[model samples]
Target: MARVAFILLCHKDPDAILNQVTRLTAAGDYVAIHFDASAAPADYRKITSALADNPNAIFVTRRVRCGWGEWSLVEATLRTLQAAFDAFAQATHFYMLSGDCMPIKSAHYAHRFLDAHDKDFIESFDFFDTDWIKTGLREERLIYRHYFNERSQKRRFYAAFALQKRLNITRAVPTGIQVMIGSQWWCLRRSSVAAVLAFTRQRPDVIRFFRTTWIPDETFFQTLVRHLVPGREIESRTLTFLMFSDYGMPVSFYNDHADLLLGQDALFARKISAEAHRLKQVLGALYASDRTDFTISNEGRTLFSFLTARGRSGRRFAPRFWEAEASIGAGRSLLIILCKKWHVAKRLTAAIRQSTDIPAFDYLFHEDDTPLPDMGGIERSLAKRGRHHRAFVRMLYDHAGTDRVVICLDTSSLDLLGDFHADRADVRILEIDCDLGDDYLIGHAIRVGLAGPQTSRDTFARLLPTIRRDMIHERDAIRDARFKNAARLRETATDAENAAALAVFLGVDDTTALALAQTPHLFVD
Candidate 1:
């Protein structure tokens, strides 16, 4: 029975906004929309006319021309919030969302949690005490007077910034109020929101000071909420899952990001691209579900964040900048075989070589016996490759000819799974479980001297390579997820099935693959 008043600040993507407004109003939630005056007039009319019949949707007439790092963004939010508050008096909470934002969690789940814990979900930290501002002016954003639009008018904006810094111009903050800064998105209890509105009318001096402050939208609500709400009642975290690049811009979400977004504990997410049809569809479906027992979003958040950072900002654990391990580029058509039974893998490699015109290489990555075509002596080559994940893959791509080349993954090759995830454009990964028996792994381990012959299957299994033991750990990232949908072929699989898998990868027919299965062993170690 908890009603939320949603304040939506939208500039583009009217279709997405209309979908969001419709979904929210249909679910018995109220929305106050402020179509930015800077946006296309046709889009505004398109969205408003579509939602005119919905009693829960209210369009703010006093729209402001909003821009980044400008006071207008904050003013626009206030106007929409006030309009929603006046219309939906029964609303218990107010949630702020953007044009690119959408709920990832169910309304029932949100209401139940909000009802149980009457906490204000807003991130507020002492601005002067934290290193939160990475790219912009830190403490000067608050202390220095700002008058120009920071985003659209960069030269004049920085000119004013320089003039203030030269003259040592400082603005005095009102007494007894410690300035705070946080994310612009938030979910707050109605009382705290109403208090903010009241503070605006009562303290014109504070408003005037902030109006000249750089990116006041990020600080105004955050600082005011802290001044009004008790520390105990405020949870210093927004209920929206937001991420930013090193450039301080919101990371846009695409269809492939569905898993990461769905696994988030946040009720909502932003910067979801309108062109991301698949992700939008998935969110639309999940938002309607009443289930509260959802997957824990924080469990995988750390690794995903690391991988994201690794992809965007070149990885720290690599040799050079762009040559980040997870971003190794392809120089030729490549197919990588991930397997356990090396002896069996060699047989398949031989089959591919003898049965067709294509060539296959095995033990190409063995630390002692790797065979490179162009690189010098093995020692010098290994030294040149540097024995690093990024280096190994880069060396391989450089020597591997423009024509198709096949190599079996080696245990000696450091973790290239991340690199494989990135360069899978020309890479084809196929996993084969060539079973001898339930004890086959143990027997193979012993035969290969990987473990003691007397050891149990469980012990031998543990001695296998990481990929041989576990298939999908870091593989959870990127297009390499296609490994999940790949056909699982056994050693004794139907010659047709085996042929099909090999053929699909080799770009040949099943007949050629069958011939490969019978060909003489040619890939000698």
Candidate 2:
């Protein structure tokens, strides 16, 4: 097996760091980590404890504060490489990664493939003439030296014009040299790392020169490799993983995007949020299982293992009617009338109205709808009383045409379902929020051993929303309703008050309640 060394730069979120380390160490690869001294000792100790038993792991020298766009990143990276080189001399290559970074490939494939090239894969793009290095740099340097860096304020004020001149000249200078940037996370041979350290040691002036420039991380290795061997040994292309970018933010992958990631044949991908359990399950089966040939972690786990996975499926996709045409079944042309309280409902209604096939929707409660007395004489002027109270009341009468599918807003529940009476068959109140909340709670209940799989899926669905809503909306009216146990309702009501029932008392969807029940672990404190 080709040995690999993983280097992680740790700062905050020690739990996340520990999980990454555990997964990497379990993969049978050597690991070296540099925790920025900027973090508290307790946090540092926590990560250290997690890696204590691993023979392939080492905690590097003391951490240092890394200023963004400065030499700190390169300094930290070099320190990690030096430590990895000394401790695991037999390792084939060193992979630089961040604490939140995840591996998209199987370890077996990564090890075999990396063993072949085992050369420098840094990607440098030329930008000497670009405004990023010219005008932008001059403007930023003045701001940084004079205002941001208090220690060098007086000295910078005198040299400010000179610095501006230098940046202008730099913009005109074309050093056909490209500043390599693939993934900051790279798979590099030991010789490449040794060369980086050796060159840095001999040329302290070069190191100091870059330390003064912005984005030292991008330039540090780029300058070294170019100055060291020119175009002889260093490969222009990088072997690291890739992720697509749109606009500015990264395009996150879903289970639907699985084929794209796998087909790309990259070593790793940028990031994977723990919230998507369905994607995790799909990816786990594909990449983290024995049936498949590729494996990234030796411990037989995938990137999903580190994140909280409970109730993930519920949030994956928006709820939608599967068969409006089929279900309508020759009835008085079914219309899904969107009610108020759900702002997104207006868009949905407009979309349905625009559709050629489906029954058109009647947008109610809009300015065109008949105004209520409290809604003021103005066209769409509903009185602005307490925000939550007015919202629920407006929701009660938002629908215009009675003969339609009066699906209530996200705030819709069985309790409020009785207010509207259209054609009994046509008036279906779709309790979307209630349904999702039930599913999330059920998932959590199962995970924490609060309920068995056989436990009624409808347990919370039928009982809680009504009971919870009543406690919130009509706390004083509890004396009227007939209940098997009034005291139990009161107690649950108190729990709701302290917990998420407050949202119910206010008029918004019970997001607080659903969030608490769905992510119980998060609400532990």
- For TM-score, the strongest prediction is 1
> What is the C-alpha lDDT profile of model 1 across 34-140, one tens digit per residue?
99998999999999899989889999998899878888988998899889889999899999998788777888888887898889999899988987778858888
How many pairs collide in each candidate, listed in order? Answer: 1, 14
- The TM-scores of all predictions, comma-separated, are 0.61, 0.47
Stretch of 10 with least lDDT, candidate 2:
483-492
RMSD of each: 14.9, 17.3
lDDT of each: 0.72, 0.49
Lowest summed lDDT across 10 adjacent residues in model 1 is found at: 469-478
Cα distance off (Å), candidate 2, residue 403 = 63
Candidate 2: how many backbone clashes?
Answer: 14
